[model samples]
Target: MKRYGHGLVLGKFYPPHAGHHHLVRTAADRCERLTVLVCAASVESLSLEDRVAWMREVHPGVRVVGTVDDIPVDVNDPAVWDAHMAVFRAAVPGRVDAVFTSEAYGEELGRRFGAESVCVDPGRSVFPVSGTAVRKDPVGCWDFLEPPVRAALARRVVVLGAESTGTTTMAWALAEHYRRRGGVWARTRYVPEYGREFSEHKLTALRTLHPGASWEEVTFASKEFPLIARRQAQLEEEAARAGSPVVFCDTDAFATTIWHERYMGGLYPAAHEPRRQHLWLLTDHTGVGFEDDGLRDGEHLRPWMTGRFREELARTGRRTVELTGPHERRLATAVAAVDALIGEGWDLADPLPETP
Candidate 1:
């Protein structure tokens, strides 16, 4: 380790994983004080504040600054080089003696800043990690992240929509498709459908009770999304316990809110707001057709609800990979995609890997 003034790290820290922590800890130990810049949450990665909090926890006495409102700098894009450079300068007040990094970009950043550099090289030998790899196969990549993160991601994906639109059909098709193929990571757990569980529960519970019958009940029903969000967290914990990777829920907490609002004309935007980041798996409704299952509110209303779903998704600005084709086709497409990801070296042994 070469001596330097202060050690600084430049990264979005989207969700500080172990790899990041290792780098930071190393830098903090070498330099007198460590300064970390938290990237803006609205950037492409769109981080939640958890990463920043984790960094704080690690270096309780370290210097911290945040660029919550600044535009995120993607160093990859030469266009933002000057802009992000300017932001970087602004993030840390005047001259620092040194910058620390584990990635090549750190060297480049150090050169740009005219600062001495200390590098912490953590390649394959250090840890086979990255949040991107972990997210792609949370269950398989569980060991890469912290236990808390793993527990938060083992959720169940439930796909739902108006009757005949292929919710149950897609669910069962996907479940069977994945199961027959041995599923990802050689894990032997069945993908459960929310509707099946809901229906079964209804068969036994409806005989004794109804789905909360007041307008308030309907409004409350509209609020089931929060329950879904809560369940997302709960299920993540369950998957961790079961040693499964993160759940690939077909539908999600927001979907629950969307359905309730449609059925009861009641609003509960809060439920979906927090889960917006989690609803990354949606299909474009541009060319999809609806089947008649009698559970659909109406055909005329199909476009309306679907439109609303898209609109809300747009509001969140998350990308969507429209699952096209018939229900069977969509299932085949989803399974193939997951398989491709696995083959590409997405981790399958862990769920939410500790900060990596």
Candidate 2:
């Protein structure tokens, strides 16, 4: 139990998990100061900046830095080891009292750094997880991941369309369907349409002065779309962080762009941003009656809005499925699409091989 003045913990940390956090915590506890170097390759799916940000958020006390290390890992080859050491030394560049790791190569890594080798959970019995396992099956290893990692990996499915096309109902039903699967899926969440809420507030405020103002009287300024879009994005992000492997959104920021076009008669670039949704389920207005809920005055414009949504979704190259027919039928189609998406799985590329 010898404490070191400066300890080093380096890894690809493609996506930091509970096991990686445990190793860092153990190293931090034993060392006066710890430096966690995250080495990522250019071909990796996750960005070096994102991995560094995650590590810094998780272990704020430890100095977390990231560098691109494209050198292939061959632990037994001295030449490969020297090449890697060069990259590591350049990133650290300071005295290293110890090298902490959970792999068998700790001894050589420490020797190269001219410091003690401290191995934590070399057998993988403590956390029982690895970066490869997590990448291969993120849903199965969901519990081993942190909120930020979960948010990044979650398959965000957005259900959106014109006013009163069963978007809200389908979003809730999809969430419930997933929740029935139990385990991590039991925590499946649905993000409501923030634009509708904003409209309600605006209508309510307008009524306070006139006391008899209707939805038609409540006008929307072009500037309001951006605020609503931002709030919708924020809500989706929060739900994705806390929900299950997939999150169902009644409407998302992408939908806001279309809504802006509908209301403002033109595209508002400020109201839209590139979203990371895996799939978009557009609830078709066909055979679905529009019900005005005191805040909706676009019943007549449903068809136009639906067409606009279709045009935008297609032009943007977003993967989308139009839900038609009865509620039960639409729900069934949506469920199948979501199941297929989940079955496809996260295709995270494997990191550089490290031979023991």
Candidate 3:
């Protein structure tokens, strides 16, 4: 290993797997000062900012920088090497004393800068993974990815419906089902319904003060819905970051909008917009008895609320799959839908946009 004043590591780090980490960490150890350049192009799916953020988060010791480059990727033409060298020099801060890479071009790149080229693990013997493999099969390669990238690629299955529709129950069931599946390295995570948490807190407060209050009297302020929506998003993001390839959300922001309409008589702007999710598993109320807890309005409002949820879902135009039956049956239906989505090549790295 050759020591250097300033070392540089450059790559797309498209989904920055363990191999990239090995390369950078190895470089950082040998050099006094190391800089990692994450080069992204227009054709790449992951944004340049996101790639930079991941590198910064993972390797706080090394300087991480990102640039949008349209230069030829992996081109060996000598004529273009000068052009590429200019770009690489411009991308890095000052003079580079050493260039570290596992590619054939490492020697040439180093020579251009009058620096030593150190090639580590050219055979991929240390970290047996590639960005292409990670992109093609994220779940299969889940162990290779860093937490931030894994979280970003986690497939979200949002279970949604009106009150007493068993959204929470089903959400847990789906998560458990995936977790128990044998030989799968990637685990599942569940995001509980945040609105219900807020409502329970408010209900406890009301019962303490009022002593005898009807469900109708436990009304929510228009202002409170936005808070619930914000918390819901935060919880979902937190769960993803914690490293789960498949995340089951009890409900999402779109459902929060419906709840605002139910009590507040209007939409809460903060909760009005829908975020990207793979599938909306709408739970049906048929044959599912509506039992009122202290927070629920009653069985009478279930039908109307369910219809309103349907309307909002349709208006948003996301991929929808309705689950109706007993608990076991509902669970089976949901599992099959998610499996189908995966079988059809659902790329977690690049989420599909909401249907226009």
Candidate whose TM-score is highest: 2
Candidate 2: residue 93 Cα off by (Å): 0.5
Q: What lDDT would each prediction earn against the true structure?
A: 0.57, 0.92, 0.82
Compared with the true structure, the alpha-carbon lDDT of candidate 3 equals 0.82
Minimal lDDT window, size 10, model 1: 347-356
RMSD of each: 9.9, 1.1, 4.5
Candidate 3 lDDT over 141-160, as tens digits, reads: 88888878867887788999
Across 55-160, the per-residue lDDT of candidate 1 in tens digits comes to 6766677886777535544557665667667778887877887888777677668877788767776473476777566555555555565644543444334454
- By the lDDT metric, which is better: model 2 or model 3? 2
lDDT of candidate 1 at residue 74, scale 0 to 100: 58
For candidate 2, write residues 1-356 as lDDT tens digits. Answer: 78999999999997899989999999999999999999999878999999999899889999999999999899889999999999999999999999999988899999999999999998889899999999998998999998888889999999999998889999999999999999999999999989989988998898899899989888888899889988888899899999999999999988888888888898786825667799999999989987978877888899999998899899999999999999989998999999899999888888877776
Worst 10 residues of 3 by lDDT: 347-356
Better of 1 and 3 by TM-score: 3
| RMSD in angstroms between candidate 1 and the native structure over all alpha carbons | 9.9
Candidate of highest lDDT: 2
TM-score leaderboard ranking: 2, 3, 1
lDDT of 1 at 3: 58
